[model samples]
Target: MKLVVEVKLLPTPLQAEALEATLCACNTAASWVSGVAFDRRTYRNFSLREHTYAEVKTRWGLGAQAAQHVIKKTCDAYATLRANLTAGRLGGPGSKRHRLASGKPIEFRAAAAQPYDDRMLSWQLDARTVSIWTTRGRLKGLAYTGGREQLATLARYRRGESDLVHRDGAWFLLATCEVPEAQPNSKPVDFLGVDLGVVNIATTSDGHVMAGRRLNRSRARDHELRAKLQRKGTKSARRRAQRRRRKEARRTRDINHKIAKHIVAEAERTGRGIGLENLTGIRERVRLRKPQRAMVHGWAFAQLGVFIAYKARRAGVPVVYVDPAYTSCTCSRCGYVDKANRVSQARFVCRSCGFVDHADRNGSRNVRARAQAFWRSGAPSTAPAALTGLDADGTPQPAVCRNASASRQ
Candidate 1:
């Protein structure tokens, strides 16, 4: 699997100035190339390069590699826009959002990240420094820092292009690394069902609930601060808002990483597969009040799911996506389904059998049941086996269920 390892650069003042200039020059040239491409209706990298290559090099003072990267970046931006239009991410063709996106030529921000090939960037792990190409010259001995694990991963598996990013007055490099995956576990006792929710970030069929109240409160505070800053309508206020936004995002990402790591570790330790709810198109399918919408929209459910999947893959743990419809309201103990079964956000009462349990826990149990059935009945998940950590022949099953309430742990 390919992962990105980010390292913060500690560049000298002069080096920072050079990098800033380089980024500005590259993006400026890319914007010009985009306009040219729009005029000629040419978007292919090589074809577009034919029209802008020489000019980009001369005008931006870019070397051969930098010039090529600039043109390629411009082409990529247009390609992404085309993909968004095709995917209906911008809405219907007749919608104003879609029309506005399709009508204008793509533009690149002055501070947009620039990709650096190996020729343009070199890393020294022992010295903790990087030598990189810049508009001023090839700048060397730019110190960098990262977590120990990230640094180790970068040294061992780093490959391909690294993106040079300038954000919030700091310089960083996002290096791609190709990490090897563990052998897939074909045999499993049972599946660990994970139910994702707004109130509870994740509830395992094992009856573990990761409540989101504290995180939600922190996010609410951040949102309020941003709104207040925006209302000020000043440059400094906007800058502060941007920094706060980044801080909130980092906090969420760190929490998700920890949660995913713990879940994967537990599954690996107990030799069980993971079952996750399929919550695709949830935002479009669900309706909420204005206040609820902000919380829902800000929730990073998909990111959490992705983290679980990749971490699971690395641990040789199989993951399955179960149908989420009615899982929340269905009775896990008696197989009864009713809207009223969910007495409140946190409680579930099955009317048929008079069973009671935590709502999210019950939902997770349903997820586990569906996953077990799907595995036995040979129902393929929407995601490919490579991504979900399953195999073509499926994992070998035990003779019988050993732990009936295994998810509780």
Candidate 2:
């Protein structure tokens, strides 16, 4: 599979300045293009895609490549905003009309110059040194294998992934790679169910819970600090608040990454497929106060899921997303549905069957059942089973059962 490898570019001071200047020029060009589009949409009957790299270069007095870079950056931003609007993820048209009319500057992030040649973007290496160059400047860094290894390590991207830009400071590169299509030769063996919740980030069908302890604590502290900072209303306090906000975000992301990695690794160790809840529209369903809302606004559950999916694919495992419908409320044993079934935050007692189990475990059992159903229907059943459970001291638990189903084989 194709992958992207990103190495930090180390340029000389002069080169850095030149690169910065090029980025500034590109930003200016993008602003101008946005202004043109705005004016046309405001007054004219039609808007045109008449802004070309060559034309921008000539009009803006920037070098040919640099001007083109700027225009591309601007177009990228427009595309991002457009996408958000189309996806109903951002404000609609005229929502930012006041800002536009006030001549407030439209901001754009720095753009990297594209490689001029198409031959896998040539790189030279000597000893421990590596370097590549674009029209703007040379990118000097460590060299990695030019193929999958390099791509995967540097870019964390696979082959065929598309590139998309966002308003955030981070850059995204997506790649899709091909693997031999999965062909199950035996009946289905076992299924591991996954349930994601606010308290416990994930509960597995095997009765294991990856609790969201760090996230909860981090969020709580962040809220407390934010309150104190707002009360102070000092410049230093505001700066400290921003620092704390960033730290909390980083901590949350780190925790999520670790949890996802552990989950995928465990699943790969077993020879069973994974079943997960399809949590679409979950964010909208969860109601919270403003402070809590802000803390959870970008929790990245989707990103975490994506990470798990891709990792599973690489390990030749399958991930199935089942409808979440009543996984939480329905009793896994008797399929009873009642609000009173969940007596507390951590307990699930079925009224019909009198089945008692950890709430997360019950959800996971339902997830596994759903996954097994999908597998029996001749759907793609590729994810491996998780490693066995844990001992009383939390050590690795041995596999207790292994039975291939009629469909899995």
Candidate 3:
């Protein structure tokens, strides 16, 4: 499977300035190329390069490979826009959002990430350094650092292009690694069912519940802080809000990672597959009050699902996605489906058989039963059980293999 491992780059002040200048120039040139492509209706790489290649090199003072990369990146941006339009992500045809998106040429941020091929970038894993091309010159011996596992992965399985990303005043290189998957456990004792929710982050069929009370409280505080900062409307306040938002994102991601790691590890240890819900269009399917909407929308159930899928894939554990309709309201014991079964957010009592269980736990058990049925019903053997279908949000994000401190120096 293809995974991306991020490593931090520690550059000298002068090197950092050069890197920043190079990125700005590349993005500026890409924006110009996008304008030309939009005006001329030419989005293909070769054809668009024919029109902008020489000019990009001369105008931006970029080398041959960099110029080519700039043009290709612009083309890719347009291609992505087209895909989004086709998928109605922007809006339906002639809608205001659709018109706004289609009416203008794409623009690249000055600090946008740039892709580097092997010809432009080289890694020195043994010395924990890198040699990369910059507008100033070929910068060599630029120190970089990563977690031990990430460094080992880079040394052993790193492949393809790496992206130079500038985020929050930090530089990182996202290196692609082609890690080999372990032999899958086709026959498992059972499936570990995980029910994802806003109140409880995850409830496994094994009766394990990872509550989200603390996380929710933290988010509420962060949200309140952001609102106050916005109301204050000062530059420093805006900056602090941005930093807090980023910190909150990191915290959420960390929590999801730990939860996913534990779930995958337990499933693998017990010889069980992982079962998840097919939560596509969940945001649209769910209806809640104004106050509850924020909590539900912020639920990162999709991210948690993706994390589980990727980790399960690496551990050679199969994952099955089952329909989630009425999983909460249905009685796991008597197989009776009724909305009245769920008496509250946390309690479930079966009206048919007088069986009582935690609502989320009962939902997880139902999910486990459905997954078992799906697996035994002669599902396709050629398909990869883990992450075979689209992710919860109807998009398959790049599988990121990250550690606790993958980019820490």
* Model 1 per-residue lDDT tens digits across residues 224-328: 999999999899999999999989987887777777888888889999988888887789899999989999999988667767877777789988888799999
Q: Pull out the clashing pairs in model 1.
A: 186-395, 186-396, 206-407, 206-408
Candidate that would win on TM-score:
3
Candidate 2, 251-358: lDDT as tens digits: 765666577777777776777767877676777897888866864665666546655664555565667778888888789998999989998879999999999999
State which candidate, 1 or 3, has the greater TM-score.
Answer: 3
Error of 3 at 223 (Å): 1.0
- Evaluated at residue 306, the lDDT of candidate 1 is 66
Local distance difference test, each candidate: 0.83, 0.57, 0.86
lDDT of 3 by residue, 1-409 (tens): 6677889999999999999999999999999999999999999999999999999999999999999999988888888789889988899999999999999999988988888999999998889999999999999999999888888888999898888888899998988777777799999899999999988999999999999999999999999999999999999999999999889888998898899999999999999998888787888887889998878878887667767877787899998888899999999888999999999999999999999999999999999998899889968422222233334443323432211122211
CA deviation > 4 Å runs, candidate 2: 1-6, 41-52, 58-66, 92-106, 109-122, 125-188, 227-243, 289-298, 378-409
Error of 2 at 284 (Å): 2.1
lDDT of 2 at 327: 84
Consecutive 10-residue window with the lowest summed lDDT within model 2: 400-409
Minimal lDDT window, size 10, model 1: 400-409
Per-residue error (Å), model 1, residue 92:
1.6
TM-score of each: 0.92, 0.71, 0.93
